[model samples]
Target: MDDAVRLESLAKSYGSGDSAVTALRDIQVSLPKGSFTAVMGPSGSGKSTLLQCAAALDRPSSGRVLIDGTDIAGLSETQLTEFRRESTGFVFQAFNLLPSLTAEQNVALPVRLAGRKPDRRTVQQALAQVGLEKKAGSRPSQLSGGQQQRVAIARALVTRPAVLFADEPTGALDLTTGRELLEVLRKLVDSPADDGLTTVVMVTHDPNVASFADRVLFLADGSLVGELISPTSEAVAARMTELAVPTC
Candidate 1:
């Protein structure tokens, strides 16, 4: 499919009956394949809800989510699990690396958990992609915060997933490290070899972080309010300011 992810009439709610609260509303969007897109919104703007539904990490209360052209809403529980494991990659604010495992082991954890012996070459290539090949033998304890996050990114990319979902991936790092990580992500999306096979979708609150993306989707009050193409930090910050102000 031309779109890596498509959401149609998507909505999400928590609780039910009189106390129900909707987190998303009639969301319709498509992420172009092999492109880098960033999602931005204020607190309670449904950014997190959108990511969870799009990644198949959680089900939407209504509507459909298509990943690689397959409707995830209709998949059985077991099938959904398999589809997610096989089609998606995720990175988050927390590194979430196992403390006892070396970098290589951590990167290969997903494959191993899927009941396959970790492929040596695959592990090596993943680590190398994130420039961590030399530290493959080191445990999380031995790495800096940036290194740990790189390992996390490596793990996410190992499976060659159709899309990589990053939520506040640079939230825990220092400015320099965050920039470095963003560059790594940018290169991944811009590289011709990867561009044909993988797409990247990231959610962040930082204007600077969002600037790296080719396009940025802005959400407010559980709905898409605007979008920015070829965004810059200044532009993003200004748009965020505009979003925060209530419309009469």
Candidate 2:
């Protein structure tokens, strides 16, 4: 499919009856293959909800989510688990690395859990993609926060997933380290190699972080309010400022 992810008439809600609260509403968007897109919103804007649904981490209460042109709504929970493991990759604010495992082991954890042999060279290549090839033997305890996050990225991309969804990936790092991480992500999307990682959808509050993406989507109150192409930090920040103001 030309679109890596497509959400059609999507909606999500919690509870039921009059007490129900909707987290996403009539969301429709298509993420083109090999493109980087960022999602931004004020608190309760459902930016995270959109990411989770699009990634198949959570099923929408209504509508359809298509990944690589296949509808996932019909998959059973058991099937969904396997589909996610095989088709998607994720990174988050927390590194979620196993403390006892070395970098290489951590990167290969997903494959190993899937009952497959962990390929040493493939794991190494994942680390090299994140510039952590030399630290493959290091444990999470031995690595800095940035290094740990890099290892997490390696782990996420090890399967060569069609898409990567990151939620505040740089939230825990220092400014310099965060930018370095962003560059790593940027490089992956811009890589010249065919069959390499090229699609990314990140959710973040930092305007600077959002600017690295080819486009930025803005959400407010569970709906997409606007989007910016070729976004700049100044422009993103200003839009965020406007989003923050309460409207009558």
Candidate 3:
């Protein structure tokens, strides 16, 4: 399968000389198109750093980041901004929704920010993808945490990005709500319409959340240590235990 994103000899550091602290070192991994991948590690393991570099949110100190076959490491600020605006989506732990705006309006913000008039139909469809079509008129404060996150997901998908980067997406939800949200994400990967297949790379500390992915990649001290295909919650937890890593 073709890679949605590929990291080659990627390394990121905080400073120079003796004060320098490396967050990622020689990380090499390829996330396939239309696949769901979970990244797991203990605290300060650089999982979020990996997501940022892969999504082009931050530049790596060295090496290359290829997204959908283009080398992003060399793109200029203007070009990179255009590329990210058109091709990538992000969902962080916080909903990042504007409390004053209705869900539909919030989803439309991305398109509007791109200097384009958002198509009402397209925004509604995006919300429908997350099963929040009917709640389009509700504001973030009027909805539950899960619904707000769903709105965030819709906002991310509104641009029809080739890749979606989610950082601890279910971290703020209860067990049932988180599981429901996971199911929504899983279905999107498994079944996409209009060739809207989206490759998902998510960072999470929960075994159950990792189990929702097609594969789980384990990281330790900014290095890829291991991986598991068709992972289950029990198996994932066992491996984390072997690594002596705390889930939280």
Candidate 4:
């Protein structure tokens, strides 16, 4: 499989000398196109930092980050902005939708921000994929937690980005709702509609949530400690317990 993202000996640190703290330590990982991956770790393990660095939201103090064979470290700030805008999609625990905009409008915002006109048909299709077609006219306050999250997912996918980085995307929803959302994300990554190019990288502490991924990476103290492919909730939970890692 082709690599959508590659990180080699990546490191991030803060402060200097005695006050120095390392957030990520010589991390190396690769995400293949169309694969769904989960990052699991205890608090302070640098899972979030890894995601931020991989997504270009934060820079590493050393090493390399590549997206589609292009080293992100070589891009200027303006070029990085363009790269992120055109190649990455983000979903956070918070819906982050504009309160005044309807679901459809929020989903269309990215395309508009890129100086392109919104295509109504594309917006509708994206919303429909997440089963939010009927609520397309609803504002964030008008929808339930799950509905709002679905809208967020729709927004992330509308631009057809090469990679989707979701930080605890299902954190705010109930079990059934979170499961539904995971299914939607799984289908989005695995289905052919994305042209076999949309890679998914999610940070999650829930074993059930991690079960939805093709692979689960375990981190300890800012370094990768283990990996599980074709994981199950029970199996992952057992491993987490063995490692004394807390779950969400």
Judged by TM-score, which candidate is best? 2
Q: For residues 107-203, write the lDDT of model 1, one tens digit per residue.
A: 9999988888888888888888788999999999999999999999989988878889999999999999999999888888877343256688999
Query: Candidate 4 at 87: error in angstroms?
Result: 0.4
Pick out the ten consecutive residues of candidate 2 with the lowest summed lDDT.
190-199
Every model: Cα RMSD to truth = 1.2, 1.0, 2.3, 2.6
lDDT of 3 by residue, 10-108 (tens): 999998999999999899999999999999987777899999999999999999999988899789999999889888999998999998899999999
The candidate 1 region of ten consecutive residues with least summed lDDT is 189-198
Q: State, as a TM-score between 0 and 1, how close model 1 is to the true structure.
A: 0.97
Candidate 4: where are CA atoms >4 Å away?
A: 194-196, 245-248
TM-score of 2: 0.98
Cα lDDT tens digits for candidate 4, 1-248: 38989999999998999999999999999999889999998888899999999999888999999987779999999999888987888999999999999999999999999899999988998898788999999999999998999999889888777889999999999999888899898888766463446689999999999999999999888999899999999999988887684447
- State each model's CA lDDT, in order: 0.92, 0.93, 0.92, 0.90
Give the TM-scores of the predictions, in the order they appear: 0.97, 0.98, 0.96, 0.95
Clashes per candidate (backbone, < 3 Å) = 0, 0, 0, 0
- Return whichever of 1 and 3 wins on TM-score: 1
TM-score ranking, best first: 2, 1, 3, 4
Query: Which digits, one per residue and each the tens of the lDDT, describe model 2 over residues 31-144?
Result: 998889999999999999999999999999999999988799989999988888878889999999999999999999999999999989889988998999999999999999
Distance (Å) between predicted and true CA of 4, model 2? 0.5
Candidate 1 stretches greater than 4 Å from native:
192-196
